[model samples]
Target: MNWKKPITSSLKSLSLSIALVCAGTYIAHAETVGEPEKEELKFGFIKLTDMAPIAIAYENGYFEDEGLYVTIEAQANWKVLLNGVIDGTLDGAHMLAGQPIAATMGYGTKAHIITPFSMDLNGNAITVSNDIWKKMKPNIPKMADGRPVHPIKADSLKPVIESLASEGKPFKMGMVFPVSTHNYELRYWLAAGGIHPGYYAPHKGDNSGQIDAQALLSVTPPPQMPSTMEAGTIHGYCVGEPWNQQAVFKGIGVPVVTDYEIWKNNPEKVFGITAAFAEKYPNTTIRLTRALIRAAKWLDDNSNANRPAAVKILSQSNYVGADYDVIANSMTGTFEYEKGDKRAVPDFNVFFRYNATYPYYSDAIWYLTQMRRWGQISDDKSDQWYKDLAAKVYRPDIYAKAAQSLIDDKLIPANEFPDFTKENGFKAPQQHFIDDIVYDGNQPNAYLEKFKLGLKKGDKL
Candidate 1:
């Protein structure tokens, strides 16, 4: 017919089709998304076994699975670790549950730090130096075998504090940080037995926390607690593992009671970041939370079948660095107070069971109440303010998102978590304190009033 014209039209059609295919491929290539906002991150932690969830996340490839490159650095102390997170030198870090609260509230170092993950529960104990333990042992009730009663209360130490005061000597106790769980737990134990742990009045320029004191509480690094007590620098200390176990090994001190005995399943360390970091990398934040949730679940899964292996990982010189036995003393579901006094404390280091990783507002409010109790919060904040701040900083919504994503992925079961649909961020009134005084996080002011010691409503320093 008309071969040249037909051939030319056919060639044009072929070229157009080829061009369309090329353009489609180019569009698909251009639309391919990049990785989440930030991928490489540095996290800080103390050399304490309670920092296990962070270590497990990094060591078990959970972070890599999330496309995150993480570096875990052991910090010199809590203050330096917190400062690193605040200045963006570190992305996030393991922290005391109260660090974010006190920092956000302008207590120690003012920074808008927050945590979506609570690290673990109940890894700390109140340890008295050998001499003090010797003196306090007499007051402690005896067992059938004549061993000092277990879970020795602060009342046992009252006469020692009194005798020290009578001799014009200050009775000193060490807590790792002013805003640490150790501080509150130690103070709670002391006050429960009628030993005043002084006060903190930032408004009065006395952030020392040693005003009107009965027992002087001060700061000591966690790892140094045993040695400091040995040197006679402090009489007793409240610190997290494996330092308490370290004391038993060194034969320098005896751990009288654990924080678990003081308050069962209490929130201990948390994984914290500055609000600015979280805001800048939202997806990265959620991904990191997801990894941590997996780590925590792995920790408590199958009734802590993985803890022995975890203790081995933690005992490596790079991590917690204590002997395997020392780390295992508490990590493997039991704790040692005096050298041979090993007791079955299955919840000594709760990583997941009992919603240990969930950042509950009630947990935050409880810490706030303790801060107010010891004067870390100088002014009289209304009860609503406490609840509001707890709600703001302890974001259960963010936690639920990470947890639900894990369940959706079949990484963990629905039974492993609190019923997110019905959780109000408040725990059902806790009655587990050593004092047997009920602590309902909903009624913080009234809870404060129940304490014969500590700051109360309308009471300013």
Candidate 2:
């Protein structure tokens, strides 16, 4: 009767109210992340386990969730990957933490590249060839079980280098790139042990980085590290997994120390895109950051419950291309130093924990300080110069935008990230270096003065 008409009207009103609420929610989400400006994208990465964030973002549909269709290509090397990003062949890349910093500073491939996400922390190790390890073994302090003590310092190798030097042989080691974290880490380790890893005087057109070096350090791509050392082309190398693990599996070398031991939870790779790309496709930039953030969280979620699956994905031919066991040796929370000397290193490959995804200016400054310390900058830079360069390359502004949107969507907790309201982009003074040097990112020059082996104020390479 008439009651039926009233009921129908109420139902229509309720439907309209619900529709309005849904529209409001949709509008909020749209404001949070607009439609991606570029849908189909290509990203480049070297075949290392830290590239897991990119692979996971694509495979786990996080990119799809942000309306992005991504194609991941494993590049021939870091330079190729960086060049692809520079030339527009790749929209972004999993880059060495130093690549963007060095690029922005005009050290190599003068282009304005920036990172909104730090990929992972502490995934590199320095491995010595079997012959070298055999020589070094007697020098290392052994535990009661006859196993070498953890965090084996480069001091154990110093005598070996000296002996080689006396024999008129150049003690050579390999790092991935000129500005790679591996290079800096190796140099740090060597210098800490009273062995000079050399310096580069780019100003003098001396890019070899062998000026008065005790241990000659040169570039060798990550995947080639094990082979290069096995072939005796290099005595040792600092590289990321699964190459270090590959050496362990092949019994060609023994990993002496990891970057985590060299510098605890040190920043490693970053997701890099040209600054022009970020400006041209802001939505795509943030959306990709969002996808990477989600992937990082997934990687470290539930105490790394997802790593076995991640290792399987990385082991596929198109990705890291290493065997599953090789990648899993480190990716699953344990790292093998020597054959049958596997030990738990839970943070060996941190993806999200400790705010690993945040692109801190402090992290950028660390790399810049290293560049200056190692003579890549070739001259003194003011503290302000470091902050300015760091601001240009490490875009935590972009990171906060992406991270906060995720928080707004209730996908992640606020406590999981640094307090955006209070984050000044500088981490607290880090004191975990192998040499026990303190790094205060706000004071780059001061930090440089603390290093006994690096250039200091008024010093030029």
Candidate 3:
């Protein structure tokens, strides 16, 4: 609970000054990184396409250019990936945006995890089994061509849930983790449609998060989602691609909606490292961020001109381990909602543009608000407390230093990043949730108050 100690220290602050000085003499208008304190670095990631930044950084030599020798390995799942970083087996990893927030807040793991870079935005989707889709299809309005309408709302599934309830069967669903964005987004979508996705009473020793539930959600890894649903273990799941598209390809399930429709340009995965790692290797931390920033720019460059090449790499067994077409279904600026119902959604997988890589405090606050909203926080908290906790976990100061160095290196155009001078870390109020809720980071307690199905100030489960 001692989040008061700043994630950065005097030595960490000095690393930026030193990098700037070295940039002046290294090359004409080029900011060169110093020799890394640790050169042999191994990073961990789950087998999801959102881990593209890390793979691209390694394949494109962005990491080597920063004097870092990197090895990228696929972890078994989120817990293994997080544990790899926490135990120092992996230097850093692609993480759920909520993992660091939850870890720092003492929700599941009590480690001080921090993220200097957000990996990408809007790459997850909610998919349902063929049977459930068949039942929900009648409720969803169809286009003239008989295609189910896009951005399918969970309201269409309510009658199905009720029917199952009448038969004394629980409506089952899956998300990757308790604190994952997938879990929150699925819960939000279900609740917006008047279905109680349920809550967690950690204080009551229930991490099950199934207290008073209508749709019972459980953890299922990304790659296993389609098979799990196929086996009737769960009816559907919310997970990042190519798992969703894999379901569509296998003909086992149909994706109901994308996270983009749930919350536009929502912050997704982040590059997470321990606070101890950041403090001990400040130069390495900034250097890796710079590399990742470049990789992200490449992914979104020329209006995603590099996606085909990126998808080819992600299809490798050591990376996402999915077919190129499955990865490309969404990564190439379009998404397949139902088979033969593909649609153009250019912003479906944003890496760099819209300042997607910057570790914004507002992004951190949103996840914290969801935790509070769903009773994971377990108590009412002051607005300032939310703000303080966000500041502790999201290191925009580190992000700023890394960004400025990229600008200095002329590696990425200065215009590609946020204006560090005027940046106060909080984004303007976001109003993109499917529920029509407006979220202002500075007023998190107020934001939580707006949700009918979640905990708010003075409310306990």
Candidate 4:
């Protein structure tokens, strides 16, 4: 069998004239990959909806098509998942977007981890306990139909935090990991509303991330978010689906806002592996990237017509393991906010649209900027340092090779991928943030300067 083996998809008939563009400054294709050097593989993921790409790849037989045997396992948490990949227990994994950059930067676990593929975009939300929501509901402005206006900002919760502070109680919240997209987004939302979410000075051995904070943030596993909050351990949390939806279904919490509302189409989880694995088994690396790309494309193809099927697969015992209706609540292209407040958010769980799978340097830099802003970096560095580090960790070169081969095989059309010929790794100036700040990846320092709340140049904790 050849790499061109036609595994069916709605886009299989797309014309080559469609075109592939929007790649960036990095390594270009050297040659098409040969047979996979490593045939049997294991990939790990935490129980979250963004891990759908890995699940889809295995179930859709894309791994088999690439002459690879993949075993998928759910890890206990993000820390365990990263450790599995680092120790070679997992060939690769569905990872938090910041895990690779933080690991490579020696933030927590010092290892050279890299991502050839990004798993999905914008599948997370911030959920608050029902008690908090009752207090916040009065502060939020309402729609004509009496529903609260969408994109509920954190300012509405400020009074509640102030009240808790007056009582000498701390305002606590949960994130999945210290370096997770959840932590960054939660901090961003809280800070945007004039709440100080706190900082981490790892250089001073303070990894608590709660230094001089108004809202203390901590880590709880994704599956444990609702229960933790329900037990009054934390007032709220920022996490990925179907956990957010799980809270609403269980009537324990109300999702205050989705990450999509905080930052439109923000980059989420990525497929990560040790850099050593990629170098030692180049063919196998490219082969896996190809399968994931196919899985991602299938997920977003035909206006998400395939999501229902994906929800069914994700609800299985071995996968995300949430109830079907709970998973389908957000997986079917709409999200439920207050149980009765379901809204059509078509891109809520983007797998491939808008070049979601491409490992852009700009995306990596954004996470780095967040790290620096929150005092995790703890020092002033040159813009070039940010750019160089992003390039080192995000391997678009490998992604380009994987994408081009798929185009050659007619498994996917060129237009479906980034224009490797012209793209420069950085996305054009982006302005989707809740605070309306513009981010130009090529000018990371300038972008950081725009944030009044977080660490920029000349500021040190």
TM-score of each: 0.92, 0.93, 0.93, 0.93
Q: How many residue pairs clash in model 1?
A: 0
Instruction: Give the alpha carbon lDDT tens digit for every residue of 1-461 in model 1.
Output: 00011111133355664784687521111011223478778899999998888888877767765657777889999999999998898999999999999889888778888899999998899988899988998898989987777678889889998998889999999999999999999999999899999998887788888999898999999989988999999988999999988989999999999998899889999999988887888777887898898889899989899999999999988788899999999999998878798888889999998899999899999999999888888777888999988876787887887777777777778998999999999999999888889999889988999989988888887
lDDT of 4 at 243: 91
lDDT of 4 at 366: 92
Which lDDT tens digits does candidate 2 get at residues 138-224? 999999999999788889899999999899999999999999999999999999999998889987889999998999999998989
User: lDDT for each of the candidates?
Assistant: 0.85, 0.89, 0.88, 0.89
Q: Model 3 over residues 26-62: C-alpha lDDT tens digits?
A: 2122245454577678899899999999889878767
Which 10-residue window of candidate 2 scores lowest in summed lDDT? 1-10
Cα lDDT of model 1 overall? Answer: 0.85
TM-score of 2: 0.93
Q: Between 1 and 4, whose TM-score is larger? A: 4
List clashing residue pairs in candidate 1. none
After superposition, the stretches of candidate 2 with alpha carbons farther than 4 Å from their true spots are: 1-31
- State how far residue 155 of model 2 sits from its true place (Å): 1.2
Kindly provide the TM-score of model 4 when superposed on the true structure, using C-alpha atoms: 0.93
